[model samples]
Target chain A: MPRVVVDVVLKPEISDPQGQAVLGALGRLGHRGVTGVRQGKHFVLDVEGTPDEAELREIAENLLANPVIEDVELHLSGD
Target chain B: MRIGVVTFPGSLDDVDAARAVRLAGGEVVPLWHADAELPAVDAVVLPGGFSYGDYLRAGAIAARQPLMRAVVDRAHAGMPVLGICNGFQVLCEAGLLPGALTRNSHLHFRNRDQALRVERADTAWTSSYAQGQTITVPVKNGEGRYVAADADLDRIEGEGRVVVRYAGGNPNGSSRDIAGVTSADGRVVGLMPHPEHAVEELTGPSVDGLGFFTSVLQGALSA
Candidate 1:
């Protein structure tokens, strides 16, 4: 079986308060080396055959992420 | 005039929106999200709610429903459509409007009587409001922050498509303090504030929200 991994993230210019809060917590926990954090969503889809990047891209653009404020990356692998 | 109020599975404000339409002297047509055929109605209102439990992004699932396709078709044909709160999110997702509503910058669920300045009073949903008039309405949401590319923001501002601007203070750090906007034809309006919840003075901060409901009737007559 093949799997498609989709990662959806907010655009670079968008403000991510959730990410900032995580970074704040990291700083408070003494992980001073980490300067920033951006939270996102990840989905792993198991398909019966080859994972089509184009089809996955369409799904990501239309459903997984909002293009106005978010970006998506797809990683494909098989077992 | 007959106004259709869509009741998605999680819709919580459809009743209030229907009541507001009836109060404004329009016949109420209750529409279900699964219904592909939109009944003959002069206008439509997408009331606010956690449709699809806000799954995979708020309003994203509901935007692709069958009824929304019918709505998209009618809206493009010049039918007046108003999307409130979560409905605003759906409108943006459905490409009927520009920009997207992101999480609040402060990361808090804000509920309050919000003051808004009417920026464009010529839209179908805002004709009753004088340009630059201030009105108070109830706004309650966690993901109501309006965001767009800097160029898009400037373009919308330059074109006078901005229908309302937040007054007094920014509630959710929306870019340019924009509270609402209208489509190019000014027939489609989407706002984060819940005007249906403020149509009655006894139950709301003011009856200022009634104008949004009434303005559509006037728009229909003149169109």
Candidate 2:
């Protein structure tokens, strides 16, 4: 089996309000070790037999994530 | 002249866009997002709404719609196109416009009458307004902050591509207080404000928004 994983995260230059809010909550809970947090999306795809990394990359860039404000990382594995 | 207004599943302002066209003395032609062929019209308007329920990202799915392909084709040929709110996001996602609209900086759904300064009035969609004119219109959205590369923003500012800039205060953390912008050719425009909602004074704060529709209508009819 072939599988591909995609991770989408906001660009570092852009502000992440959700992550900030989470950080504030964590502070209230006394989590002192964590300095910062960022929220992102993760996707896993099972391509059955052989998977084309180029095609999966295209889909992730075009539909799964917006490159203007996000960065995508693709990981492939075989089992 | 006839103007086409596109409607996606979650489109909330197609009726208001159509009404503005009528008020501007232009016949309205309804265009469905799923439809491949656009009706015979002088121009197209992508009204504001949560198209595809803003899935994955705002305007991401709707930008790939069949109707958008047709609109893009016409826009490239110099046909005027106006996109408001979510429609603006679609334009960016479709590559008809630059930059992207993301969540508001404060992460709140904002609805208010906002003041905007018309930066340029030479485009097909803003020929009726004078340069440096100020107008008030409704601005409402959950994710409307605009973002782009610094070089791109600088280039746009240098080329006079910015159409409108927010006045009084930065409403949504848009880069350089930009509220609207036009394509390099001045045919395609996208803005995150609801000008259609302000076309009628009784329904909105002011009727200043009518100029956008009238400008395009007159331009098309005269051409």
Candidate 3:
């Protein structure tokens, strides 16, 4: 069996308020040395056989991330 | 004139949109998300709601529905389409319109009476409004911030595709204070404000929103 992992994140220019909020909370909790923070989505997919790279890329591009404001990266691993 | 209002599983404003059409002297036709066939209607309105539970992304799931494919084809063929709130998200996701609606910068679910200035009046859904006319409508959303690449924004702005802009203050931090926009042919329009919710003075802040519904009906009359 194989697994595909997709990580989706907003473009660098796009602001991530959720990440900012988390950063603020970290500061309040006395955690230091953090320059900045950003948040995103991670999706894990399981397959019965070898995953087709093109199909996984298509799914990540069209469904997991919108190209307008977000970028996606896909990784495959075997169980 | 006959107008169709699409009702997705989580749609909350379809009834109000249909009522606005009837009040504007047009017939109302209910369209469902699963149905690919659209009835004989002069125009279509995609009302607001959290369709598909806003899963994966706002309007992303609903944008791929069977009916939206037909709507996209019709929109390209010059049929008038008005997308409000979530519907606006759907239009962007479906590629019927440009840009994408993202999470609000302020991180709040804002609901209020918003003021907007009509930027273009020749569009099918804005013909009733005068250029520069200011109107108030209800805007309620959690993810309504409009964003696009710099080049795309410049292109759309250069083409005068912007239909309306925020008048008093920026509500959701949309780029250039844009409240709404239209397709190149000016037939397909999408906005964050709830025009259908503001069509009746008795229930809404004012009757200013009626013009959106009436504008299409008037266009049908002349076409």
Candidate 4:
């Protein structure tokens, strides 16, 4: 089995509404001094067979990363 | 025809998606997120819902599901794939489509019947509709904002991959009012609206969403 790690990040300068909402709520709850908040996700997978880098890149381009406001970094392990 | 609906943990709309597939004159197959097989289905639907509870990010955790590998493979093989709402987010997360869905510009969870223009009706999922036709579909999500680089947006527009655009007003501040898009081959489509919820006239919206399912079916039969 091969492992694939996916790192997803929102682009800089783009407003994060969800993160801002959380920040606002936190401020209301008496937690202050939090200047910025941005949220993203990461995934590590174990798959059945070896996947070529090109195939993985295609996966990242087509299904794993939205080329619009997010960038995806895919690291293949144990290939 | 058999349509497969992939269910990730915390998926809220897979059942409805399956029902929509059945109503659209197709057999429904349930595919688990952990499974690698795509079943013997002619099409696939990545339905709406907060998969993995939107913990890491909306649709981000679910995008890495084991079954998604097969889904990506089959989708690239020209199998028609539709992603609605959260499914759309998953599509973006999985890199099946361009643009990332962010929080609503107003910083709220928007749920409403939105009017959208069918920008490109030639795709497998939208061929039944006329280009520039307006349709209403329900959109509900906290992270439905769509954003992309200007160049990428221009390229998508240039390539005619943009399938739908918000009509009256930008609901979630999507770039260029883009509500839906198709792959280069027009086989895979992802949209930020719940078309399945608006399929029936009794559901309060126009029965325009049914065209998506019908179009895919017709396209499959024709091919």
Q: Which model, 1 or 4, shows the larger TM-score?
A: 1
Interface root mean square deviation per prediction: 0.7, 1.2, 1.1, 3.4
Ranking by lDDT: 1, 3, 2, 4
DockQ leader: 1
lDDT of each: 0.93, 0.91, 0.91, 0.84
**B62-174 per-residue lDDT for model 3 (tens digits):** 99999999999889999999999999999999988999999888889999999999999999999999999999999999999988878888998999989999888888888
**Per-residue lDDT of B1-223 in model 1, one digit per residue for the tens?**
9999999989989999999998888999999999999989999999999999999998999999999999999999999999999999999999999999999999999999999999999999999999999999999999999999888899989988899999999999999999999999999999999999888878999989999999999877777
Local accuracy of candidate 2 as per-residue lDDT tens digits, B1-223 = 8899999999999999999999988899999999999888889999999999998899999999998989989889988999999999999999999889988888889899999999989998899999999999999999899888788889889999999999998888898999999999988889998889988868999999999999997787677
Model 4 Cα shift for residue B107 (angstroms):
1.0
> Over the full model, what C-alpha lDDT does candidate 2 score relative to the true structure?
0.91
- Show model 1 residue runs off by greater than 4 Å: none
lDDT of 4 by residue, B57-152 (tens): 678878878888888888889888999988988888888898778778897788899999999889999999999899998888888887787778
Residue B96, candidate 3: alpha-carbon lDDT: 88
Per-residue accuracy of model 3 over A12-79 as CA lDDT, tens digit each: 88788889999999999889788699999999999777799999999999988999889988888722
Candidate 3, B110: how far from true, in Å?
A: 0.6
Those runs of model 4 whose alpha carbons end farther than 4 Å from true positions after fitting are A1-9, A18-79
> What TM-scores do the predictions have?
0.98, 0.96, 0.97, 0.80
Docking class of 1: high
